[model samples]
Target: MEDSEKNIELKINQISQKLKEIRLSKGYTSYETFAFENELNRVQYWRIESGKNITLKTLLKVLEIHQISLEDFFRNL
Candidate 1:
């Protein structure tokens, strides 16, 4: 893969990791529980946490649910 492609993949993985960190910090042991409690699609949330491509709107919504700003979420990433 090209360097750019690799970088993109790395960033996606970071985002996924951050999301998982947030969920765990919030005391959620299961992604399904987090999604269900947030009224999000369980499969979609699972896909997101698995480093799949995500829409900016969906990302923003998820961050909001976690009470975190995009700037904060992406900080030092």
Candidate 2:
């Protein structure tokens, strides 16, 4: 893949890992529960957690569910 693609992939992985960590730390037992709490479908939540290229709206929603702003999310990294 191109360097840009690789960078985006890495960012996606990092975001996914962060989300997983937050979910686990919050006592979520399953992705399905996480999805339900976030108002998303299980498969859609899986796709986000798997680092698939999701829409910006979906990304924002996930972060919002975690009570994180886009700026804050990246700033802490």
Cα lDDT, model 2, residue 13: 91
Across residues 11-37, which tens digit of lDDT does each residue of candidate 1 receive?
Answer: 999999989999999999999999999
Q: Please, what is the whole-model Cα lDDT of each candidate in the order they appear?
A: 0.93, 0.84
For 1-77, candidate 2 gives per-residue lDDT tens digits of 99999998888898888878878888997999989876799998888788886778988888888788889877765
Candidate 2 steric clashes: 0
Structure candidate 1, residue pairs in collision: none
Give the runs in model 2 whose Cα sits over 4 Å from its true position.
none
TM-score per prediction, in order, is 0.97, 0.84
User: In angstroms, how far off is 42's CA in candidate 2?
Assistant: 0.8
Please tell me which predicted candidate would have the highest lDDT against the true structure. Answer: 1
Clashing pairs in 2: none
TM-score of 1: 0.97
| Residue 21 shift from truth in candidate 2, angstroms | 1.2
Looking at candidate 1, the ten consecutive residues that score lowest on lDDT are 49-58
Best by TM-score: 1
Give the C-alpha miss distance for residue 76 in model 2, angstroms: 3.7
